[model samples]
Target: MLEQKHMALLEEAERRAIAPTDNIRACFELLALTGAIDRDCAVRLARHRLSEGKFVLLFLLHDKPDGLSPHELAERAGVTRATITGLLDGLERDGFIARRGGLEDRRKIAVALTEVGRQMARELFSEHTQWVASLFEGFTADERKTLHELLQRIWRNLDAGKQQTGQTADARA
Candidate 1:
């Protein structure tokens, strides 16, 4: 099985004096699993002619009917304004979105989904939901809840590490 292969690799690593502690093995496995998941998700999105950024922008605009400014979209999407501009350009070229003057302020531009875009989002949304649900098909409801809690704990640990690093840097400064 896959688990046996992983165990054999870990054993080889340990035999080679590669310092394969339990924590190190756990971290390696987690990173490998997440990297594979990310790659698979990207492949799925590409089937619809969407990069992750484009897909995110599409859904964000889909949720916000009125529209959002380039700056706002960049912040919401966790990308740079320049990156957002490139995505918007591609979406507009494909006729999936439109950039128009804001209703409240004519000078300000807001991006909105066109009818075509809305229709695509609706279809993609359903497919995406099923795809995500499939990822958890092996887990029971309680197992899913436990997994969520454990992931949250890991996130908190990462956040705490970041804060500690910042404090150390500030102290050195």
Candidate 2:
């Protein structure tokens, strides 16, 4: 837990040394400097292995082990169902996924990663994770924890702001 004095010091540092707008700009700058945008583009390029169809499915599957339906993918990725459908179609065409009739009934189609897809997802996820980890090699564990907690709280405040602006759903939507 943070003491009030520590919180005040952190707040004072942000107020005096880092304007909110400037901090946001710096974040973008750091992303660019560290080539996170480039990394994302590389991942996007790997999609061309099968029109990024398999890659997106693999990433989503790995992100949610229980698995995600095409509709869930669209919501999580902030994409349209048609887009997810297209991606799934291409992935299925490439043998990275398979569709099964719903267990209890035969009406719904559920998708799952094929073994090949799982292997590919694991490899890509590991590669990207290593790259991200290398970026913070200088931070100690305690610093990392502190940063994580502060960022989480800040994120909540930002979410609250979005709610206030009607950008986020009401009732924690």
Which candidate wins on lDDT?
Answer: 1
Give the TM-score comparing model 2 with the true structure, all chains together.
0.55
lDDT of 2: 0.68
Q: Estimated TM-score per prediction?
A: 0.78, 0.55
Off by over 4 Å in 2: 1-28, 34-56, 59-68, 142-173
Poorest lDDT segment (10 consecutive residues) of candidate 1:
164-173
For candidate 2, write residues 19-129 as lDDT tens digits.
564565545554455465556656755654654444566787764544566787788767799899888887788777787775665677677888877877787777667
Tens digit of lDDT per residue, candidate 1, span 49-91? 7888998888999988889999999999999989999999989
- Colliding pairs, model 2: 47-52
RMSD of each: 4.6, 9.8
